[model samples]
Target: MKRKSLIITLLILGSILFANGWDVQEYPYDLYVYYIVTKAPEKYENLIGSSVVAVTSHRHGDFGNAFNSSCKSGVIEFLENEDFVIDKMDGIDSTFLSKSFIEKYFPEVLCADISVSKEDLSYIWENLSSKYVGFSDMKKRGLNKKKFNKIKNTSELKALFDKYMEDCHFDMKIREFTYYQETAYDEGCKKSKDQRDIYFEQETSNAYYVRFTSCVEANANYFTNLEAVGVIGRNKEFIILDARSNYGGSNYVQEKLQKILNLEKYKGTVIVLQDNWSTSSGEVWSIFGNEKSQFKTLLVGTHSGGMQNYDRSNTIKNDDLNIEISFGSKYLGKILPKNYLGEGKGYEPDIWATTETMASVLTGLGVDVTGITFQ
Candidate 1:
């Protein structure tokens, strides 16, 4: 009776500590500033006494529901209270490039098939082009201030933006909604229906393959699946981790994997397969295999989606705005500089290969490919 009572009390305390969402009082926007100041305060050490809004503008995806007008107003108010400057003309200038304005006047820009007049183009260039060109991905794509400022017309801007969009693996857009569909590297090899989150099989006598479809903490089999892989592949010469198209979930998965996969005892190479589709926690897993694991690790396939720089994401709700903003509590730049593949920049692999050519690539690396199929 006493044990049952203790368990119930603990459960209640846990629920209270981790409520559905953080109340408005526990504002994550402010907490993000505190975290940057205390935890990862290398380059951002000056932020200790600086205004929160200074750092906020430089970050991307810090606020989850940024489109909500009420939320935006609340955020602006919060920044203003913290002595952050807000130009009164900002709203007026941005009104011309808003979603409603674009839909009504320049709908063709939505489809990237628009040819606007010089006056309209110049207006857009003055208002939106600076922000777009300032994007990290755009800068990485060789779009510099000199080149962008020199552009005289809409055609050049469109051409540059289009090319950047095409070449950039990670979606980077200004005030535009982008959706990514996770795709499996090998569609023919269907995952076992019984084992949905993780699937493992001995591809060869010396090699074992494990595919992680999702890393969501809610998946009951996450830990067990990883434990099973550790037990089964203890003596295997090679362990292949396929994380293609895995758009990460919980860091709990990373913790569980670290404990289960005892790389120190296992004398074998761990090969992680990743692509541009593998992001966030998926990239975290790949980084663990390559940088954290005690075993010999090799990162294969193309660059991994770079979205693991920030972690410990928590949602904070604002009752006034009726909005929940999810923001990361920790910045990983100082902690994991090697894996700190910035926004829209993926982790480059040691061996780059596609799904079609992976087998040949591995074989060339002295990994036995006899009777080993990708499926």
Candidate 2:
């Protein structure tokens, strides 16, 4: 029990230390995991009777066309230097895209054509609460799986969604929303309210640090509220990277943010406080060694979730609902590497700290964080 208390004390202290301005850089580890993704168009058949279609994106199509050519294969031989590794992926957020085109492609079929009610087809997605009745549930309900087998093509699937929407008063909640324009990387960030006055005096640098506790489950809630979060810049001062929650957003967004922060060689600490829940983008941004700069990254928390998920596209056909399926495909080899010190563990922390340690570290700083808060 005493040992456990000691661990917690260190983490709390570490957090406080960061609230003040000090940098004790550390190393990151690598681990292996993979995610899958899929995409496709809806058809009338899928809606009326039932069917499942595997999907791909324009990215795969273009790349396959280019890479499949014998000439492209020859280029691969030359490019396969010992240091070179190939990994390509993009475009998987929510599946919903649009409905009109789906209907145009797929018209209603004879009632004899399919089984899953238009009600069962889309109700779960429209009302997130009805999720238990989702396609997965329909099979358990003993209605949907049997119905989908009859869906001969994508067009039929499309008609079903159109009718489903009209019947259940279901509007695609995702369709109406537009994604905000991503902020440019060069733009400065603002210090959070909690950090100021209590932590360090406001300081500015082109170099930046963002400490975080990666929580994959956070995505289930965080991504849903992204727009409301909005862009935050430093107050009446110059900060390069903002520290909001520090531990959210999809891996794709974080990957983009990492490259953006990599502008001009950075010499400062980019601390990310991680726990086992630190996954997806958290893992990628924490230990991506591809960058040229020697990042003064501090991993002061526990072993990070070293799961790296690669996505394979899944597309829905014959439905007005514009959702593409994404499932786990292959695992990217471990970014969280094993060492003589430890193996099959989470990412290593250079300046390891527990929650209690973090508290003490902050206490030692004797900061006057006027603008920061603990809650």
Candidate 3:
């Protein structure tokens, strides 16, 4: 009777603590262990059973050393207790715990509309860990192993989402609205010459100029239309692609240009004008134009904006620290060659053209660039 009574009391206490949630500063190890096993994405599902404790120790140790040196003492002790190697915790960014990851693995969590902010996540971690006896007996409730395979395409995914949206009445953001805007821009660029900055010098009869402001689908369509109208054909001796101040968008436009135009057929000088504002997709396009073009494409103007590697990021709210942690998951490769670090060091120019000298450079090619603005 005494043993039974003690067990009951402990169970009640555990329930209460679970409802309250964890204080990460006080119970960091407990919180970390709970999240890494239960809440982390399926991609990291390998980190579930036996490796949970080690993974938790590794992440916490990394976090502690980087952000708070005071926690390093406690974190070190925890790692040692777990039999985890301290050296293995080197390159982990534990600040912004994966939000997209959770969404991908557990879409059901979205139906609850729970505000899982930094404070909320901490509270959840505390609550979950408080009631936890052992991982062996943990309930694997709603995690469907074949969730991704169920919906093969976007249409099927949309159908499933529609059912959920109707049942939940969740306020969905208009993400597809940009598609309509892109369509309108495409139509305008194709129909009206004034809509886009594309010109062929009839006086020189040998120079074709196109100042693409952005590397978008619309600009690609406009360039295609220009090609159809005989504006960028074999008649030209020189082609000036002014992408100066273009801060990038999609590289599909560049790909389309290479495909439809077949730049090699027109054995003219392909000059690409770029500046500090030419970045991201713009830099990518410049690199593609230089490498893919059979006729070596000349990169004119100053160095481009060097931000190369493309990655999708999620902003996680850290209320405790009063800062937002933007965590990037996927690492899309650099635009330039392996030697160049495109973050700070952009692509070097073959013929350097500044704001003052650009007009003269164009004029030297027997093409007047008086009214033409660097788009």
Candidate 4:
């Protein structure tokens, strides 16, 4: 009996060591969570209204490879009240990271903990060496510091706070200086100025025009910006609503705009050019407006991008670096399903406006585009 007890004790110790087994003395207890933000029920009225957060990092690891702290409890508690969701979040065990599907969507939030006597940074440095570029990367980033301060606004960062933390002046980690938000990268992916101009001018210019490329969210920006510009009568005097590139964006923005549009300035007729590319929020906007707008909705292009539902996301937990990790996304309901002229089935346009038709429409004067195509 005594021998068995000793064996069990050894096994427990072995498990702990093996789970986060590394020669380095300390490493943070990592946690990961990914979710999407669908609605802003008055509580979350700040951050960029409803958006999808896609957690893009994963490693083939077991579930509880590093659960040695109360961090998991802290995180779960934090996310309990937010407008976010976990795809399959259960308890701490299920909620934590391992070599599972969870990792596929979310990365293990790494906390680069390095207390004075704790000696965790060294261990973390060694453990993450393979993941990062080099140990110099850790050294340069002051990973050895117990706590690092970060200022969100650059002006704020420039206005240095005299107060100092334990690791304030620690050796600077070069090349490791970067804000943890998705700024330039995401913005770059948005539609270019030229593209927006063309779409705006052609669509709203009282003439017939079509959009070449578009994303659901980005296209939402395009449409809204175009309306703003149209209010000033700067670009397209009339817009050809071609959602061929629109997949969709914020639900509220689309719905609210429809109501506002029906009021004035355009109580007559409008031509909408679309195709199969219209998706997500784009399809919803197209369907709702066309079906219930005061203007004569003439769909000349194909059906819009077939978008049934939208996936919501958010960050429930972040790494030691204060970089949060997102959990699974909460899939939202379809704002418009049947409205998808060519989601999966096929897109059918009113005038069957194609490449040739578009050219001809642009050349001819704005009169009657009826029977323009041979059905």
Model 4 per-residue lDDT tens digits across residues 1-375: 999999999999987645432111123434533222222223333321222222221110112323333243333233333312222222111122222222332233321222222222333233334332223333564544333233333233222211221111111211222112110111111111122212333333243333423443535555555444324322333545445434344445444545555655454445555444344444444444446666555556544433343232433222444322221133333334344432242234556545435646534536333323211
Error of 3 at 79 (Å): 58
* Per-prediction TM-score: 0.46, 0.31, 0.41, 0.34
Candidate 1 TM-score, C-alpha based:
0.46
lDDT of 1 by residue, 1-375 (tens): 999999999999887644421212213442231111111113323333222222111112212212212233333333223322211121211100112222333344344332334444344344334333234544577766556655554455556666543222223222232212122222122111122245445467678776675677645555456656766777788888777655667656565555556644778877888765566777754446545566677888776666654553444433432323233445454445455455555677778777667789988876766665552
lDDT agreement of model 3 with the native: 0.41
Best by TM-score: 1
> Can you rank all candidates by TM-score, best first?
1, 3, 4, 2
How many Å off is the CA of 45 in candidate 4? 47
Q: Rate the local accuracy (lDDT) of all candidates.
A: 0.48, 0.30, 0.41, 0.35
Instruction: Report lDDT (Cα) of residue 341, candidate 3.
Output: 38
The CA-based lDDT of model 2 is what? 0.30
Which window of ten consecutive residues has the lowest lDDT sum in model 2? 178-187
